[model samples]
Target chain A: MNEYTYPIIAGITVGTALRVFMLRTDYRQYPTYLHGKIIHLSLGFIAAALGTIAIPSIMEKEFTAVTFLTLAASQFREVRNMERNTLTEMDSYELVPRGNTYIEGIAVAFESRNYLVIFTSFVVTLCYLAINGWAALGAAFVCFVISSLLMSGSKLSDIVTVELSELSFKGAGLYVDNIYIMNIGLPERQDEILKYGMGFILTPKSFSVRSTIANLGQRQAILHDVSVTLGVFRDSGTPALVPLIKRDLNDGRIGVFILPQEKDPVRAKEIISSVPVLENAIQMPSRKRNREG
Target chain B: MKMEKAILAAITTQSEKVTGSTAVFHCETKEEMEAVAANLEAILDGIAHALSDRLYIIVKH
Candidate 1:
């Protein structure tokens, strides 16, 4: 057997094994179309093996280049297809939580080592033409190891997590338009939100108000336009009698109030003095208050 | 479970527009969702381990 024969055989073997593993493992975890892909990969390996065995060339350099490029192109296509499919899958869900449903994006990165192996393979193929004819085969073996490690490693961790919390919540369903946003933040945190998450979309004018309502959920509260006095006190000292007053505050205490603009200082001060801390405040408002108070 | 499935189906249908990729299976119930989540977690862990190995190989090489 020529030097190229060994490396070609090894590549076929490793690639075949990988294809098989992907096919057998939780195909259900992936979409239905992936089933066909699994088959395609298997066939691709067979073709690679055949190509290497059948093609005979004196140059050896020409043979190596042809084989490597073909294999690389095929594998690259597979990866690209998978990524495209994954993105399509992500698009079906309503990422913004309205009721119980949740969605998140998974971010996957290309393995640098895989690129390195591809580079190494090309270099080794050239080397095999020059010096130790057998050396190219050894390089191919190393490339396989590197590629496998990269394929099986951190690249997989990048899959996005999308979840739906409280399956029973009304309006908890997926929408077709929501797509996965990429390269924003950590996938894990996004996954957490997707799994047990709630969210709302708001226009620019009502963004703050909508966000507050989203956070509060269906909790009971009064809505008011009036401002309230808010006091920030140090843990040790007693709160000042005259609280730092902010006007037009929708402080949950005086009902769910939406302050349209900054509260009038005079009105806020008057309201703070008149209202008793323990009396008019809503139920459990004390618990909501700063313990330092 | 049915609800989860419905939600998943909705996501699957819509996923194409939103993500530009194919939608996988949906988790219709809490149990199913949890199972899928666990599987994904394991896969992620495996991937992480594999990356670390690859990193070592690169460093060595």
Candidate 2:
């Protein structure tokens, strides 16, 4: 066997292991079924295989095999589209729809993970090519941590303070920490609201954080994540139970109101803090100010 | 005095007539039921708050 043989094997083993590590159906409950997991795992293995083989193929001067990497890139793009289409179809049936931005983020994450598998394999194999097998294994462990960190990204808690807020009704309008939510009509419905509704106040630490939460898409995501974590007290055709997130007109503070089947304010706060800030929703106003100066 | 969905259905069905009626909005606070009341008839009949955030206007007609 050639000296390169063990390096290829090491790359495939480490890279495939990392890919499997990424398969988790946590709080989001995405890819809810076994079939979905299987599809992604299968794609991950293929990605790792291509990545492991690329260096050796180039060393052997078999230039044509490198074209397969381009082919794999296009395949991952299709996977992203597939995830988006499935989520959108299911979202139409949800009580609190996870707006398109959140759906797009999930699709992007899945696609990017496959690319991560490819990257881990390439890096590990390159290390193997340069050093002994034992050293390469240690280097692979470090590579694993780096890959996971890249995928983790920043969370909502990084920029805001999420806490339980009082839910009150002033006249016909619902108020969460003085933020005006939509009006509530029907006495029994109001009774139901008083019974199971919970309110959360997300106070931004800075102007950019304020703008991020103010974004309609980000607010919708907060509602979707919270409702997904704690069951929604709503069904189709019951628009009254829809979750709402509105901002204080003066200070730009966001208030979230939801009628959850299980009203645990502590858990609701955790879910909000854990929510990923939408990349598209992040508003860097200071950048503009700097440019003006 | 509670509003019923039947009244809302009727008002929705007779929306064209309601539009022609004099619009004297009682509660100017942008509540949907208040708007519904304004659209149903000239006089502010009454306001009813329903299932958190849902506004309904029920007229005797």
Candidate 3:
């Protein structure tokens, strides 16, 4: 085989491996099925191949081949749309549906990650052809580190303090801390809520964070993640037993009322802390205020 | 625009308490009113909210 063939193979291998490493079937429960994984892996392979071949084309003085990257961009954008459609369709059946913001965030991640795969392959191939195989390996390691850092968004714990609160009822109203969640007129339903319901209060760490945590989509994402992890204590036709998040206008704190099947407050708090802060839900009102002042 | 929330039925012990376009169910006792409201909540797939000791209104959210 020729010199470019070995470099191309090395680049594709590294890129595909990076993609596999990134594609995790974690508690998020996405891409968990075999078919979903296959689709992503196939797309990752195509991205890797496209990235690796670009370097040799440039070396051979075929500048027209660089236009292929634009095609990759549009293709990856289609990946985002596919992810959005699939997640949105399935969300309706979820007990605690992941809001549109969370779905869009996931879709964006899928799209951006393909670009990262392309970048990783392009860098690896350039190193392999320019220097040697050893340099390519080193570059691949650096790419992995950078890709991980870029991929991971901040968590809820970074912006808010999650604390378990006593769920109390004032007449028929459900109260989590001082924040009123909702009302249950039925005493039987109220008893069921008391037996299974858990409440957590999230206090924003900063002024800007108050607005961010108050976003309806962000609150829904928190509920969805916790419900998925701990198992929700709800079913169809029982709308009164639904999980809800209510905000405190006085202190900019939020009260979360969840009815998980497993009544473990400790694990629930940990899940709340670990919930990813959705990119779209982040608001920086203080930044604008500071600039205006 | 579509109404996001509407009172589906009103179960009340006091006949004079609830008046509007919504359906009203008058109960003889507080127990009967509670039973009626609970059944309405389940059947209508809505939440029954108590306005007073005599009245419970089932609202779809």
TM-score of chain A of each: 0.31, 0.95, 0.98
How well is each residue in A1-293 modelled by candidate 2, as lDDT tens digits?
99888998888888888888888788888877999988998899899889989988888899999999999999999999999999999999887889998898889988999899888888788788877777778878987898888878778999998888888878667889889887665545567888899988888888878788888888899999888889999765455657899989787788889988888888888888999988878889989999999
Candidate 3 deviant stretches above 4 angstroms: A289-293
Interface RMSD (Å), every candidate: 18.4, 8.9, 0.8
- Residue B50, candidate 3: alpha-carbon lDDT: 76
Of 1 and 3, the candidate ranking higher by lDDT? 3
**Position A27, candidate 1: lDDT:** 13
The better-scoring model by TM-score among 1 and 2 is 2
lDDT of each: 0.32, 0.78, 0.94
Q: What ranges in model 1 sit over 4 Å off?
A: A1-7, A19-28, A31-34, A43-75, A78-82, A86-145, A152-293, B1-61
lDDT of 2 by residue, B1-61 (tens): 7655333322222233344343322333445554554344333233343322333344332
Worst 10 residues of 1 chain B by lDDT: B52-61
**Candidate 1 chain A weakest ten by summed lDDT:** A97-106
Of 1 and 2, the candidate ahead on lDDT is 2
Top model number, TM-score = 3
- A51-91 per-residue lDDT for model 1 (tens digits): 33432343533555455556665665555455546545654
TM-score of each: 0.28, 0.84, 0.98
